[model samples]
Target: MHEVKAKGILSAQNGMNIYKGCTHGCIYCDARSTCYQMDHAFEDIAVKVNAPELLEQALRRKRKKCMIGTGAMSDPYLHLEKELCLTRRCLEIIDEYGYGLAIQTKSDMLLRDLDIMKRINQKTKCVVQMTLTTFDERLCQILEPHVCTTSRRIEVLNILREEGIPTIVWMTPILPFINDTEENIRSILSACRKAEVYGIMTFGIGLTLRDGNRQYFYQKLDQHFSGMKERYIKTYGNAYQLPVPRGKELMKLVRQECSDAGIEWRTEKIFEYMHQFEDKEVGRQLTLFD
Candidate 1:
């Protein structure tokens, strides 16, 4: 890992990535796409040494309070976080400034900061977003190596739920011919329902393959699912979407399951929920006290 002084921290939408690159080694990670133009190796994380200071300044300067998002391009709680604590420090700043947080991660290490997350939620809002790709533990290990398995993430979700910190699960990138089966989708949705997640975000029952990620994913496919790479190239040559065969049926099932479980499934609505900073209980309590 290397530290760099960054020019800016927060995006126009209050989004920030404290690090560049990820070590989780998700076989289908889009961050590996050459379009991102990273000069260093994907595993060699780039730390924004000034992230905490920059976040404090940015939050203080903002005239309006809004939810700040992180872990879009890279997982904020990567292995480096175990020692660096950059994410934790930033959370302290967010809590101190009474700003909302919408943080995403693959590591259960995020639970270590439950205190700050709870404090921030008490003041503003805090939503934890986690991605569940494969339901089977062994498959999850193969797909998302270097991170917690599906069951562990589900445990984290349940813990967060008990804490009253709303959680959102990103059910995505169901690799075709590998994990795009109805049973896999149903099992993941069942876990989400059991966790009482506030929302489940999925574009469809499929994954995307581009220049950088596709090559790497194909390499893994060859190693694990011999002949799968050839099948992908033959089926989806130079295509981007790479939707599964049962896309329509899978989506219909998801719609029914989520609707029945009271879990938000619409991408736009879920995004709106995550981005919209809620202060309902805080505002109501303040009014009553006043």
Candidate 2:
């Protein structure tokens, strides 16, 4: 890991990535795509040393409170976070400023900051988003080798549920011919249902393959699932969007299941929910006086 002073932290849309690159070795990571243009290796994490300071300044300058999002380009709870605690410090600032939070991660390390997140939720809104690509533990380990598996993430979701903190599940990048089966989708949705997640975001039952990420994904496929690379090449040559053969059927299943469970399945609605900021403290203050 290397530290670099960032000029700014928050994005125009109120999102921030305290770190660049990632340690979670998810084979289908779109962040590795050359389109993103990272100068360093994907594993060599670039830490924004001044992230907390920048964030605090940004929040203070904001004329109105809004939801602050992170973990889009890279997971904030990477292994480096265990020692650096930069993400934790940022969370403290967001909570202190009474701003809402929408953080996404694949690691259970986020549980360490449960206190700060709970406080943020109490004061405003705090939504935790977790990406669950594969339901099978073995497949999960193979796909996301460096991070915690799906089952552990479900446990984290349950913990957040008990804390009255809303959670969202990102079921994405579903690799075709590998983990695009109905059984896999059903199992993951079942877990989300049990966790009482606020929503599940999935584009469809497939993953994207581009120049940088495609080569890396093919390499992993060759290493683990022999003949898989050839199959992919034969099926989707030079195609960016490689939807699963049964994408329509699986997507229909997802919609039906999510609707039955009262979980938000529409992408637009979920994005709106995460972007919208709610101030519970206002109601609490009114209640106290009454």
Candidate 3:
């Protein structure tokens, strides 16, 4: 990991990524796509040494409280986070400023900050978002080689549920011909229901492939699933979105399952929930003192 001084920390929408590049090694990472223009090796991990300080400044200047988001372009709980604690420091600042948190990751290390998350939720809101691509443990290892598997993430979700911290599941990038089966989708959705997740965000049954990520994904396919690359080339042939043949059917099932469980499926609504900030202390005062 290398340290760099960032000019700014939070986005106009209040999203932040404490680090650039990732070591989680997901085979189909869109962050590695050429459009993002990452300058260093994807695993080098550029650490924003000033992230906590910059976040504190940003939170102090804001006139109104809102949810602060992170882990969009890179997982904030990556292995480097264990030592650097940049994410932890930023969380402390958000808690200090009374802002909500909406953090996304595919790692189990989030348990390390469970106390901070509970503190934030008690004051305002804290939504933990976990991405589950496949339910089969062996397949999960092949797809997201370096991070925690789906079962462990489910455990994290259940723990969050018990802690009164809301959670969301991102069931995305369902690779065509690899993980786009009805059974796989059903299994993941079933697990989400068991975990009592507040919402499920899905973009149909397919994955996107671009100039940079497409090449790397194909290479891994050749390594793990022989002849899969040729099949993809023949089926997709330079297309960006690789929708599965059964995408429509699979998505219909997804909608029905979410409806049955009362878990949200609308992407916009879920995002609105994450961005909206509510102060429980203020609500309590209004209810009792109004």
Misplaced by over 4 Å in model 1 are 281-290
Candidate ranking (lDDT, best to worst): 2, 3, 1
lDDT of 3 by residue, 151-252 (tens): 999999999989999999999989988998889999999999988999999876789999899889999999999999999999999999889999999989
Q: Tens digit of lDDT per residue, candidate 2, span 1-290?
A: 88899999988888999999999999999999999999999999999999999999999998888889999999999999999999999999999999889999999999999999989998888999999988899999999999999999999999999999999999998888999988899999999999999999998778888889988999999989999999999999989999999999999999999999999999989988888888785763211111
The TM-score obtained by model 2 is 0.97
lDDT of 1: 0.90
lDDT over C-alpha atoms for residue 252 of model 3: 93
Alpha-carbon TM-score of each model against the true structure: 0.96, 0.97, 0.97
lDDT tens readout by residue for model 1, 51-130 = 99999989889876788899889998999998999999999999898778899998999999999999998877899999
Q: Output the worst ten-in-a-row residue range by lDDT, candidate 1.
A: 281-290
lDDT of 2 at 92: 98
Q: What C-alpha lDDT values do all the predictions have? A: 0.90, 0.92, 0.91
Query: What pairs collide in candidate 1?
Result: none
Instruction: Name every residue pair that clashes in candidate 2.
Output: none
